[model samples]
Target: MRIKVLALSLIGCCSAMAWAQQKEPTKPAETEVYEPVPPKVRVNEKGIPSDAIVLFDGSNLDAWMSGRDGDAAQWTLNADGSMTVKDKAGDIRTRQEFGSVQLHIEWKSPAEVQRKGQNRGNSGIFLQDRYEVQVLDNNNNDTYVNGQVGSIYKQAIPLAMASKPSGEWNTYDIIYHAPVFGKLGEVIQKGSLTVIHNGVLIQDHFELLGTTEYIGWPKNKPHGKGAIRLQDHRDNSRVSYRNIWVRELE
Candidate 1:
């Protein structure tokens, strides 16, 4: 019986030693993936990626329509390749609808400053026409941090203030992921936003709660792909936008 136990222990030890002697790949190519080749994208001199959809190139409003009634966009297109808000003309939105995307847009507040707080240079870039990335001239201005420039509206506060001067062009590069909903209008996965303001990281992949609301809590209403809407604000803010483009994500 003792010799039998000793033989069994020896067998186990030998098996363990044999397994330990097997080695993993030491070369990089052994684990490299090469079948799925990524497509090439060319960036123009204006820094527009070839695969990106040009929403606004300062040439025309063909890609946009009235946000209120879906008519011709009424924003003022300038010679310098920028569009200024038409105040009472209502908001403008892209004619094309999208889901998750990478959006790039440049905006500038009026050179001549105006009212304080939410009234100054107030506008917004709405993803899915629901989630808003607050657009305001926060340079030398004070407002609620969660509603300031680079914020995910009243939901997520920005990590930092990266506003250029009021009149200077400030760029917003946003990577947005739309929410996934269950069959019965329940949230399966919350949406998220990553925002870069004027080349500075402000919002770091912040998960959104729901739709951005000013007077009440956000509502999670299940919906499909939606248009990108630029807020009018209707305050005579005269916020200008240019060089708008987006790259859709799979």
Candidate 2:
């Protein structure tokens, strides 16, 4: 019995010693990844990337058409390098269709605050011509949170209100992922959007449920690539836009 106890104690001591001598986990090795810089045209001195498609460079409206019936875009193109909304001209959309894309656009509300609430310099940028990223004069202006500037229309509220004062330009840098549909027109993977408004992160990789609607619940309608639509509002808001560009993604 004495020998057995001594043997057990020794075994326990050896095990404890082994455990104490064990080393901690080694850290993973660091490796560098190679990412080549792409070429860019840098038009309008906007620093637009080389792989981007210039939609409007403050020159003309050749890349756009009327969203109502595919007619030519009739918005007033100013010599000041911006396009002003000609009320009653109907919504304008890009003639070229795109799927997933990284889009950059700059807009400014009229210097004069015309109307209040939903009618205050209201406009929108519709991805796939369906999902809306609302544009409004929310600076010192109050409205529904989900329908305010930088919101996804009435669907998703912005994380922050990032709108400049009236007449000041605000930039929207959006990265959109198109939804994938199955064979039977069912959504296999939902789309997502990441929006940076005026250099502020508002929508942080928001998952789009479906098409943005103002009257009813959002619905998923299977559709292919579509043009980027700009709402006219038709209320004489006089919103101006310039320096629009997009980069298609795979």
Q: Which candidate is the best by TM-score?
A: 1
The 10 consecutive residues of candidate 2 with the worst lDDT sum are 27-36
TM-score for each predicted model, relative to the true structure: 0.89, 0.84
lDDT of 1 by residue, 1-250 (tens): 3443344345445687664674654666544554346899999999999999999998999999999899999999999999999989999999999999999999999999999999999999999999999999888889899999999989999998988887899999999999999999999999999999988999999999999999899999999999999999999999999999999996
Q: What local distance difference test score does each model get?
A: 0.92, 0.88
Q: On residues 166-231, what C-alpha lDDT tens digit does candidate 2 reach at each position?
A: 999999999999999999999999999999998999998898989999899899989999999999
Q: For candidate 1, what is the TM-score?
A: 0.89
Error of 1 at 234 (Å): 0.8
